[model samples]
Target: MFQPTGQKRLTNVSVIRYKRGRKRFEIACYPSTVLSYRAGHLKDLSEVLQVDEVFENVSKGKVAASGDLRECFGTTDRAKIIRQILERGELQVSERERQYGLRNSLQEIANIIAAKTVSRATQRPIPVGLVYKALQEAHFSVQPTRSVKAQALEAIRLLQQHSELDLERARMRLRVHVPAQHDAKRLQERLVQIETDAAKKAKRGEVGSAAQVAAGASVRGGSDTSASLQMVQVESEEWLTGGALLWTLQIDPGWFRTLEQIVAEETHGSGTVEVISLRVLHEGDHLNDVL
Candidate 1:
């Protein structure tokens, strides 16, 4: 805490941008800095005013020698923002609460407000920019939050798009070793279901089959269901006589891991789940021969 004499009163105002580019207003007048007073007893000039309080004091013209700070911005909107703060306090939705990164502040208030408003109005996410229209309809004009909300919504859209592609690109080839005591009937049923699902997806243009590799460079081929199925023997002495199976599965990588875990758990940790190959699909690769 730095002290100033009565004749040399000093006032310092600092604006800091924090998480999600939210602004935090801090004012240090004569006694203490905004963050310093929270540390308990120190010096005479140690009482700090946080931004929310600053908003109230500044709006009322209470603090002495704050004319310059007061004149820096339009008073009309400041009164509205302060009023909204006093009325709404902070935007909070219990049902929309997440277990992680819960925040309460003015910085992301617009984003939260827009997201909630859109979700409530349409039961889905609308563009963040559109939130301004909704706010306008509600007679609430907060421009900063509108811009922040729009950016946040755009970021969310990009994340969702990337995640969908990641899921589509997670296909893999599993080389599984069957236990000697494993039931043959169950394995056949599982294989049949896998082939059926593959054919369905292929028909929908959702994936390409390795069986079409030699016929063309791309996955597009004739309606031969056999194109998605391939088998090879494991070069192990124990699996020399049809004891092992190698099959390619086109699925999200996470699903494959989950399936592997289930198999391991069911087999009392005796089953083998080996990834023979993992493919990163591109536009052309899906149509080309099996890698």
Candidate 2:
């Protein structure tokens, strides 16, 4: 005969994606089922829930005997339900629903216990065994000692310490390695060599001399007067104090012709023009600033 077998309520249910391809498909299953399958190849979890509930009620004096508890589950043997519930908790509820439902059930049980019954001389709180039984029936594992606040605080502290250490280590490793002074000296020497080679090239007419190339020292007319002469060098400290100056100039065609004539007269058939100090100066100062 069918008695008042415990009613089944679906606590949680959701569709899970099983596979995806050209054709996508999903399946609906309870988290308890998945967890149980992973833990062991056990089946028939609903029976477990019924048996646990009956056993719990009987244990709490709500039921008279094992037969009565079995009758409650509409079965002669309650062992089957008990074993199922022990092996696997509630399968009817999804993870989400089970979580909320379990909490709510606990709270309700706490309230009911608080309202009823009185204590003796000491006046202690009446324990709600039924509430605990209900949770066990629902496959909710209750820990006697669980502190959410404490766990959260511990996690936060650990994360903060780790982050601080990481930042400090990074800062310590940051360093800019400057080039050696010897390297700088070598570079300067190379530059001087390049300038000397350039000067030799200028003498061979392969390149223009510094005097001919100095800026603001271009010839004005076809005349070769002292006033029209190019300043080759400046010996004043005022010009050399800041730094060396190098520059270039473009001579007028007429001035160039006159200068060539003057040089021809002075050298008198000397096939090559000999270059002395080839520096072009402007107002007792060199033309360009060298870094």
Candidate 3:
């Protein structure tokens, strides 16, 4: 052993091991970083590796022989060899770690849902616990490697069909055809202003009513805005012929009437608002039960 484990510190260390012939190469990596690196979300090696040095035996802190690097990679450069090891190595993830990751991802999906959705009747943001209960009831198979937003969308669909809880998505998905160029601009500005005001109120701890709290909630991965990134996100936008605009929006259900007013005012009652799907939320009592 080159050094005792007590003498070294590698917090949350996970090993990525590569083998060639009788020689085994290893790198100490950040446990949390391996999945992201493997998914290609992270490219920089420095961000992944805990220590730059390749190891013959990581637990013992024994460095690999220089000749082995040349034999395997045809180069003695430590950085290059480490890169190859990282690329080809099998990351060692235990069942426990995987379960932990699954839990975290499930919670994240629940959070995004809570932030974006509300009770159809009360128009209040659903508590995180209630979202989890719905997920559990729906038998959502939480996949840690999957996108949370995509999972959230799927969860909504599943909850509507299978779970006891119901949601209001029909009123939220609006297909609008603005008759003029300026009308689209006006509609976007009005919705943005509403979101900005709500987000500011949320930050200031002014959640006085159910509607207010729902409006104040943030869209975790839904909107592209810098500040509020609020509701009424543009799902699709296209400029139509003869100076008109067509749009598909995913918005807060609570804003349906306000949206109707905005659309009516902007297009002077000429634009069409198409509705897609609706699943009623009649679970305020259930939400309390879960909480």
Candidate 2: regions farther than 4 A off = 1-12, 41-291
> What is candidate 1's lDDT per residue for 71-167, written digit by digit as tens?
4433434434333333333322233332122222222543553333223122233444454334334334223233545544443333334422111
lDDT of 3 by residue, 1-291 (tens): 565542343556889899999889889998788878877999999999888888887777777888888897788898888878787898777789878888888899888777666665465567789889889877799876579988987787577568766554422566778999888788777777866787678678885543344464334333344234355656567888887888766556656667777789889999878776432233545321111
User: What order do you get sorting by TM-score, best first?
Assistant: 3, 1, 2
Please give the distance, in angstroms, between residue 261's alpha carbon in candidate 3 and its true position after superposition.
24
Model 2 local distance difference test score = 0.32
What local lDDT does model 3 show for residue 114?
A: 74
Q: How many steric overlaps does candidate 3 have?
A: 2
Candidate closer to the true structure by TM-score (higher is better), 1 or 2: 1
Off by over 4 Å in 1: 1-167, 194-242, 246-250, 265-268, 276-278, 282-291
Instruction: List pairs with backbone clashes in candidate 1.
Output: 31-45, 31-46, 32-45, 217-287, 217-288, 218-287, 218-288, 219-287
Best by TM-score: 3
